[model samples]
Target: AQSVTQLDSQVPVFEEAPVELRCNYSSSVSVYLFWYVQYPNQGLQLLLKYLSGSTLVESINGFEAEFNKSQTSFHLRKPSVHISDTAEYFCAVKQSGGSYIPTFGRGTSLIVHP
Candidate 1:
């Protein structure tokens, strides 16, 4: 089945601490990669994407991730995070030659302490 799996459902860390959210996907064909962030009571925003190029990609913010074709994984990371970074992150994949709608992981919730 086309799906994405996020290893950690929730991560709690102190303010300014670093964090990483693991993501893995299984697809039959090539796929587009994306990481989206959603703050409380808001819509999802595109954090980064790995369309076609070097496996590594970064967001406008400080988040970054690498797309590994061999392992079929894309893990997100951020160093020295702020409390404002607390939010839910989702990993998604859109299959090539298929609908544009992406299949997303359950989601990883980041809790930043003060």
Candidate 2:
């Protein structure tokens, strides 16, 4: 079994500033980690994922997350931000085998101000 935890419900940041969205998870079995972003009312989009090798993963949009097995954490960070970066971020964990259902966090809303 696996569970996800989003440390912050909301994160406020200014445009061009760096930001981090914290996520932690627990599972008895090996799992895959993922980060998803939702823009306003739109659907969730796959941002990045850690499937096998290399604990570090990045998205095309400049967001990156490191999977820490010791701490059971996958924290998302962006060196710089834009107003368009505003969205709700979700952290997820899925059992490595068998089923594909993933446990998602409550979501952390990132509000970028000008």
Candidate 3:
């Protein structure tokens, strides 16, 4: 089974500052990585993903993450953040196969102070 670990439980950053949410995983086989964001009351939404083809992937919201197989890490980063970007971020991992189930991290709460 695969497992995900989020280094920090909370990150406090001011407006217009770059943020990086660290994520690491352990899996015996090849796996896919994903970053999901959860708003106040909404469900988890996909922020970015690293499937195959490319080692790096970016979201439409200006967040990017690179899949490093050797290091078994996929960290999410954003150049500049806004107060609206404050949310809970999660790192998920699942084996590459027909299974759609993913093991999720505890989640990192990003507080974008103004």
lDDT of each: 0.93, 0.96, 0.95
Model 2 TM-score is 0.97
Residue 74's lDDT in candidate 1: 97
Give stretches of model 2 more than 4 Å off: none
- Assess every candidate by TM-score: 0.94, 0.97, 0.97
The residue-level lDDT of candidate 3 at 77 comes to 94
Candidate 1's displacement at residue 10, Å, is 0.5
Q: Clashing residue pairs, candidate 3?
A: none
lDDT of 1 by residue, 1-114 (tens): 579999999999998888889999999988999999999999999999988889999987899999999999999999879888999999999987556789999999999999
The 10 consecutive residues of candidate 2 with the worst lDDT sum are: 94-103
Against the true structure, candidate 1 reaches a TM-score of 0.94
Model 3 lDDT per residue over 1-114, tens place = 999999999999999999999999999988989999999999999998888988889999999998998899999999999999999999999999777699999999999999
Candidate 1 Cα outliers beyond 4 Å, as residue runs: 97-99
Residue 35 in model 2: lDDT:
98
lDDT of 2 by residue, 1-114 (tens): 789999999999999999999999999999999999999789999999999899999999999999999999999999999999999999999999666899999999999999
Worst 10 residues of 1 by lDDT: 94-103
